[model samples]
Target: MAVTDVTYTRHSAEAAAGLMDELCTVYADAYGQVAGEDTTVKADAFRDRATGALSARNYELVTARADGELVGFVFGYSLRQERDWFAGLDPAPEAGFTDERGGERTVVLAEIEVRKAWQGQGVGRSLHDTFLGGRLEERATLSANPDATATHALYEGWGWQRVGTKPGRPGAYYREYAVFVRRLPLLDRR
Candidate 1:
């Protein structure tokens, strides 16, 4: 299917809950099975966090729907302090670029997922464009697993350049995660 059939919208807190569920399901299907761990719990926790952030007006959840079913989503928040949704987590060095933009900034894409069935369908790209395109933030950043070469390729294809990598947790199957950054055009200027 063409991306044109996908519709993007800013989801309300209530709507975000459903979208987050789909997001988690996709992530678990993509990353959990190979790791020999159940990520349903983690996914649930992430959904709660996303909902809380949206309720607190700290982030916005953008969802893509096709045939009235949620297929992909991107969750992000405006940065206001030193710590954020991913606080205390060992972020890759390049994640630093996201913090360089002070005052009315956006920090962290808590999650972005597209169902495995929808992989390579341009749904992820559509979500990214709808979520980040024309935003006024000076820059945006994301941390992706280095082992996921396809994901790295996707981000790089979208103009997000890798700036650094961080060591992974002990015994973790993935060795390190890379941080990618992309500068956005000023909204007013655009």
Candidate 2:
């Protein structure tokens, strides 16, 4: 598809509240039918997940618009000590792989997607770059659905490499997902 026009908006977690419905629509439109779940269930889950991430420390949200209509968004937050999100990572990582204080050194790319109709035109990439480009984290990580090979390839193409695969937890909606990590460029803050 021809990508002739696009724009991006960066929002702090609290400020992004007004766009929740639109964000929900885009997320549902992209992921609603996954793993035997229906649109309503997936949409509801997205809402809950977004709500949780909104309260995270240093949370960030970025939305992409193509020709003035919402197409996609990317958002994440610094992983904190209390969460210890990486403690059980399979293969155990190489060593010293995460924030010592729980979440300070890493940013988690919690959710990102381009609407179904907007997938092939690089909207997702645009959202990703613009969202993470300014991050202060030393490392970034995400878990992609293993069944979605295209997403695996997309992450690889964007400089992320597979770190390990995470088995599905009991009763979790997620499938077995491939965990990937990337070292983000350290920007001078001084």
Candidate 3:
């Protein structure tokens, strides 16, 4: 997957509703072998979460293609006050950190990845920039495994700031992921 051969596309989560199968394939192919994880199971879970996100208010997907083949994608949705994504935080974040009264307050960037052959050459960055460039949100947030240093490095180089870390609990072991935040540029309307 050469950088010059790539093209990007944006789709509303509704328009991308039927793409779970393909998206799962991309996810498995990107994370399966390296992580020594079961591809099918991971894909299944991803499909379920993605479906839920699709039904959410303002979910979006950004895909990257190389010669019209799916090479990578980034997907997430706007965070809302009604959602309890922040409730599980151990030490908790600043007061009103999860507040989303205006709906566009923050976007929870859920996932992003590129095929192995295409990584380290800017495909991920391109996909990320393309995904976030047009957002109207005030900021963006994401949670990532604390051990995934390389992934964190990529995000840090791109301007993400670590806000805090969450600890694992019995019912929500994955809460150990570190939370990161980055302010998004507001497009001038004046």
- Model 2 residue 162 lDDT? 88
Local distance difference test values of all predictions, in order: 0.67, 0.82, 0.80
Clashing residue pairs in candidate 3 are none
Clashes of each: 1, 5, 0
- In model 3, where do residues sit more than 4 Å from their true spots? 34-36, 167-175
Residues forming the 10-long window of minimal summed lDDT in candidate 2: 95-104
Q: Is candidate 2 or candidate 3 better by lDDT?
A: 2
Tens-place lDDT per residue, model 2, 25-136, is 8887786476765678667877888988999988999988877788899999988877666656777776667554545688989999888888888888888898889798
Alpha-carbon runs more than 4 Å astray in model 2: 1-4, 32-36, 169-171
Number of the candidate with higher TM-score, 1 or 2: 2
lDDT of 3: 0.80
Clashes of 3: 0
Worst 10 residues of 3 by lDDT: 166-175
Looking at candidate 3, what is the lDDT of residue 28?
A: 77
Candidate with the greatest lDDT versus the true structure:
2
| Pairs of residues clashing in candidate 2 | 79-103, 80-102, 80-103, 81-102, 81-103
The TM-scores of all predictions, comma-separated, are: 0.75, 0.90, 0.89
lDDT, candidate 3, 1-190, per-residue tens = 4688898889987678877777887887787574666667767777777788897767889998887778889988888877766666746777888788777788888889777677788888998898888778889988888888888887899999877777654544375878788999998743
